[model samples]
Target: MWGRTARRRCPRGLRRGREALLVLLALLALAGLGSVLRARHGAGARAADPGPPRTPRLGRREPVLPRPPVPANALGARGEAVRLQLQGEELRLQEESVRLHQINIYLSDRISLHRRLPERWNPLCKEKKYDYDNLPRTSVIIAFYNEAWSTLLRTVYSVLETSPDILLEEVILVDDYSDREHLKERLANELSGLPKVRLIRANKREGLVRARLLGASAARGDVLTFLDCHCECHEGWLEPLLQRIHEEESAVVCPVIDVIDWNTFEYLGNSGEPQIGGFDWRLVFTWHTVPERERIRMRSPVDVIRSPTMAGGLFAVSKKYFEYLGSYDTGMEVWGGENLEFSFRIWQCGGVLETHPCSHVGHVFPKQAPYSRNKALANSVRAAEVWMDEFKELYYHRNPHARLEPFGDVTERKQLRAKLQCKDFKWFLETVYPELHVPEDRPGFFGMLQNQGLKDYCFDYNPPDENQIVGHQVILYVCHGMGHNQFFEYTSQKEIRYNTHQPEGCIAVEAGMDILIMHLCEETAPENQKFILQEDGSLFHEQSKKCVQAARKESSDSFVPLLRDCTNSDHQKWFFKERML
Candidate 1:
């Protein structure tokens, strides 16, 4: 040991060398650690901030979350500990957010319903002005069953804030026997303070059709506007819709519906021209890009465009005209086919259906429906029986299981149809919906490819892109009724086709193939081209004798169909519900 005076000190050079060596070792260790970190994180270089999420679209993937905040002085050991603590807090907040999202069903419902939406104006709307003073006062009737508090209240406020006081007569809220605590006396208490708002509760749970009828009967306004409980009215959403109805009482007009993101709650406006409502042969609702013919036919893009169907969520109609046309098929249960029934009835019963592009309203479309849909199936059968006529075979081809489903009495509806002397479905199809595909030749062998084991998963052929280009990998996807990709037509000749392009190609399979592919339907049938429709709903191959099945690999988020032995397994039992009729 050296004294403070350093009488017996070591060599200065040796001391300096030891100090330098220690510093060098520390530098080397830091460099090595930095290189390891770079190698690991270089592939996924993250941005400091990723801004807000994009608006959700129909059949599109969920948007990415915004970047979380980070501390600025996160350096050194103590700072590192503080950073970890902050990260943990963020994690807790994320968990709480997820819990709230799960309960609300839509992410936006977790936020304040009174929260402001971004202003998006349609160019056509800006250029035009409606006779707002002359437009009839509208009785906005909204119906709900167990709707979230924010979602329901937001719809009410959106209407109140957007609509002119003089133009809006009242907002009728029909609660279909909601069991939620928030919707009980608390809801009544809230509504009691709001002017021109009435809350009606059904003693028993009635379907939307009847619930709407109840609201309509109670309505005193000249025009009746029906909106879903989860909707946001834009600045001028009401004026144009009411103007169109005022122009023609027989016109059942709908506004341009903008989508409110189900996951992120971002409001997406009409970016392109606009989309009009259409239906497939199955009578399932669909959206199509405006045809050039329609553009030429209309006086202007802002002008009301004739539509063959309504989405059932939002529409404005003259109260007298609504009553004259038979308000709704009162027999329709819980909710499913009333929109199509109303659409068909409107067309066949001498009423015109149109969509007003100048008016825009945002609607929340959930990924999964909130309520039970078995009643919707029953309601669909009722519509087919009453209105579809001989064309109903096409519907049955798409939904074979619906034909035998117990749908309550439609005798009154049938009498109404006959009493009105409604045009035959043929004339309506030829005249009103000529663009719709007619599957008269389609036999009843094809439908949704539902797996017996995985009841939720279906054998879907819809390609990744909405466009069904040739050689697109056909995979299993969630079925939304005989939709574009969901359509399956199993021919009498034992060939399965999709989306009504029969004879173009049948669902082809080959021996020793792990996955199924859509090959061209040849005039001269190959061994792989042939298939056998078993009574058990399995598609058995003529060559391989294996049944068609969707893979049961751990996750159902995505998967493909596979070849397996025909057994009593539910996996093998599949329903080709949609046909190439």
Candidate 2:
């Protein structure tokens, strides 16, 4: 009986063990099914409404952060023109606007500092890819001298907003002895809340060139970018510049500078066609359409254009290369010819100067600069004396007074050129800048044109301002042989060009009207501007079949020039100052 009871107890224990095993297996199966259902539900949820993406494990994958999207609804977004009707007090403020910033500060203050710009680049640029991870970081230097509050901050915000945080080290604001009250503690306080920004105040009034050097000295990045205080940087503006500098350490790159309307504060995008920098005999920076040679060299529309010079207000260069090139000429005072000086140095000293179409920056082009321009002439003279070599004579011919201007000592600069063994200005002209028209290219009379009939009176032309060179009346005035307004260049092209600057004026005659006016010189040498200076010293108009004759205006005692029938009269006889010698 004990044996049978033991056997039954054993069976009962075994049965209980089997039941516990079955329960455990069933629980495992149920849990597995629940997990499958949860996974399927999760997948369905993701398909229906995916939440913010989960970043891959940090070390496992390096992710590219997308650029911050510009606010579409913000004011002045998409670079649309902002027009505001002004009356009463608002209209009165416009004068003050011009006096301060040379821009419509009223409108600038109203627009959002973080406003969006339209994608002005070619569609090809959108497809272009760059290795952002490997690109050099830049420290943007902005030098302001009593810059307006809104425009200055807007410039700062535009850079901070548009530039990749990883690529931008900092923005160094160099105050060039600003006396404005707002630019002191108030400006400091405003920038204090911003990250990656530094303010350096000069003890005395340092000019733009020195101020930029100050900022560059404080920079701690692979590249140094210089921007005007009143500028708006666009998307992708900094990348191509830094990329070019990364690829070619000797390359100094600039963006396609867009125009920001001064009167309206409207952001005007530049034409897709790039304009490279060139200078006239004046040694002043001027823009010209990219030559066919440069365009042919480009494999794509977005390729970098080899520019002879820069607009000087905006550019990026490797810090090491900049220092190696001796940086800016600290001897330069105020603002003027540094662009041409640096541009010449770069090419002559075995460096490349480029303008990248993929990069764009909007600049506020003022009606007139709100500062004294007395130093600009001196600055230009300095550049000519340093880098121009024998070519300096061309500049002196156009601007005779510049020879008398007291440009500071350039012995150190000359020594630097000798130290670097830089190529001569002739090489610069023949190789880097062949498009520049050297005045001596054609053999013709050039100087202050004096008329024999009018005695001491010369062909004096004074435009309303420098920019209004075209479509101005040429008048007769007392000949002052200082070689300014009376200067004229009778080119081999048979066009009497006003020798003031590039985009020089040509004396033109209307089809029916007898007026002799100064018009913008055309490349085609239009028949109307063609004139033949005869052996007898008469300016015969080729197109009108007439001669430029001096006549007294019935309205006043002043003599005015007009096209008249060709005659052997003394009134038709003219002589260039060089011919008289």
lDDT of each: 0.71, 0.82
Estimate, for each residue in 455-500, the C-alpha lDDT of model 1 and write its tens digit. Answer: 6676666555433434655577666664445667666566666644
Best by lDDT: 2
User: What local lDDT score does residue 173 receive in model 1, on the 0 to 100 scale?
Assistant: 99
Q: Over all chains combined, what TM-score does candidate 2 have? A: 0.82
Which one is best on TM-score? 2
Cand. 2 Cα-lDDT? 0.82
Q: Which ten residues in a row have the lowest lDDT in candidate 2?
A: 1-10
lDDT of 2 by residue, 475-553 (tens): 9998776675787888889988886676778898876888878888877799999999999999898888888898998
